[model samples]
Target: MTTVLERSPGSEAPPPSSSPLTTDARGRRRKATDVTMRVLVTAAFLVALIPLISLLYEVISRGVRMLSWEFLSTDMQGVFGDMTSGGILHALLGTVQITALATLISAPIGLLAAIYLVEYGKGRLARVLTFFVDVMTGIPSIVAGLFAVALFALLVGPDYRSGLMGAIALSVLMIPVVVRSCEEMLKLVPNELREAAYALGVPKWLTIVKVVLRTSLAGIVTSIVLAIARVIGETAPLLLTVGIVTQVNTNMLDGRVATLPVFAYSQYSQDALGVGADRAWGAAFVLIVLIMLLNLVARFISRRFSIAER
Candidate 1:
């Protein structure tokens, strides 16, 4: 009878009630933390947006009226006037060519370097490569230009200024950015996946080629686009190396290139501010649009590729 005092098999005592003041204090603290976090996030976003908003406002206010097809399509060869002047066609073309060439050179090297760093690299050489990449990252754009100028002086003589030189300088600037970005993206691919590929008896090279690269291809492409954007607006390198011209020169190996940034600099530096200033603003507008388009295209491509992977 003493052992037959029935009790529920799994039931437990209820948790003790917390004091009302303590409960209220905890609730208030949670609310306060939430409010503080919201305030901080809002402030951070505003701070981030202010510069971009200001730039867009200024560019639009000054250059909206100049946004005609004639202004963008016709080359500003000989025309000069006040507030109503020539176009940025040649500079636009040169900027495109120069950035394209730079991307062509940098993207491959950067992607390969990233692959080696993340996949094949394991020892002191990897560490050295990482250190060098870090140093390159901090090197000024002007220094890259100077390096290109100095290097070319030995090979092509003192008067050697070509779009190819400009591209090489830009490649120097772009490679580090691409390497860092692609390396990060590649690192995000799980070691578990790599191991699974290895478990399946796949060779390391094939695993990297078939699984690693494909998985990270979208990010690699985005990194390439971002690197292109980084160098597209460069002025100093083009100024020192390519030299500016009013006319179009398509050959990257020899002759003056008319990139948008250098074109803007030339226009603004002219003795008079009438037509030159106007054209400079217009070129700036075009450059902005082109960068914007590139970013959009990158996002689109990344999205499409990501969806396809899924």
Candidate 2:
């Protein structure tokens, strides 16, 4: 039997393509969102940079003429009525010395405390210590300085202002920061590494020293840099405990000191503007440079440690 093909019923054609207007509307919405995000990002970046740019501009305009080798090298004691005579050398030296001493005093203690809290301590005491640490972190810088001064004075008599006292004040301020940072770093260390060390018959202390600390050394160093940076610019503590002087102070235990912050403060607290203002701007510029250098050093140290870890 021959089968004849049946004729198909009439059928509507497929709907025509969507209008260009619809496509254009979707494209416009996407473009609008993109533009909004770009604008927001640009605004945020500019906001972040405004203060820095303004500061740099102000300092450069006021200080560039006054920033000379003599201005950086000579001390301000004998200089009178002229911005060109005094330099930041003494203050810079004191700043370096005090901050170094403070870091040395704080870093070890804080790191050990963090190790104890993270590795050994358990339950309630750890919690209490942690809470106290948080509280310490919030303590005002001036309060830390006052506490140091009062405590030291009570112990060693009232005539006890020295560079060492300033260091101690800065150390008190730095410890909580170092502790918090180190504790976070230690916590980031994997438990598996500890277990493996234990399985290898290594002692807990050795395991921590060789494994945990090694793994977290970069972070620890970064914490230390942060601690240094935190205290480096502290004016109140140094002002109260160290007692600013124009001369360089090498002895932490004996004499008054001049730090960059104090030096900058003294310059800015002038009776009349003009030259003193110029000196203040110059000192500020120097401080900014010092801080920037420190940040670079921190980055370098972190990167080196990270590479060694790998």
Candidate closest to the true structure, highest lDDT:
1
- Cα-based lDDT at residue 122, candidate 2: 98
* TM-score on alpha carbons, each prediction: 0.88, 0.86
Give the per-residue lDDT digits (tens) of candidate 2, residues 1-310: 9999765688666798776544788877887898999999999999999998988899778767878998888887877666356788889899989999999899999999999999998999999999999999999999988988898889998887788899999999999999999999999999999999999999999999999998998899999888888889889988899877777779988878999888878777863476777777787778777888988988888888873546
Which parts of model 1 are misplaced by more than 4 Å?
A: 1-30, 80-83, 271-273, 307-309
lDDT for 98 in candidate 1 is 87
Please state every model's RMSD to the true fold in angstroms.
Answer: 3.7, 4.5
Per-residue lDDT tens digits for candidate 1, residues 1-310, read: 3667666989877999977644798777887898999999999999999999999988777767678988878776786555355677889889999899988899999999999999989899999999999999999899999999999999889999899999999999999999999999999888988999999999999999988988888998899998888889999989999878867788989998888999888888983456677677777888888989999999988888873657
Best by TM-score: 1
Q: Give the alpha-carbon lDDT of every model.
A: 0.88, 0.87
Clashing pairs in 2: none
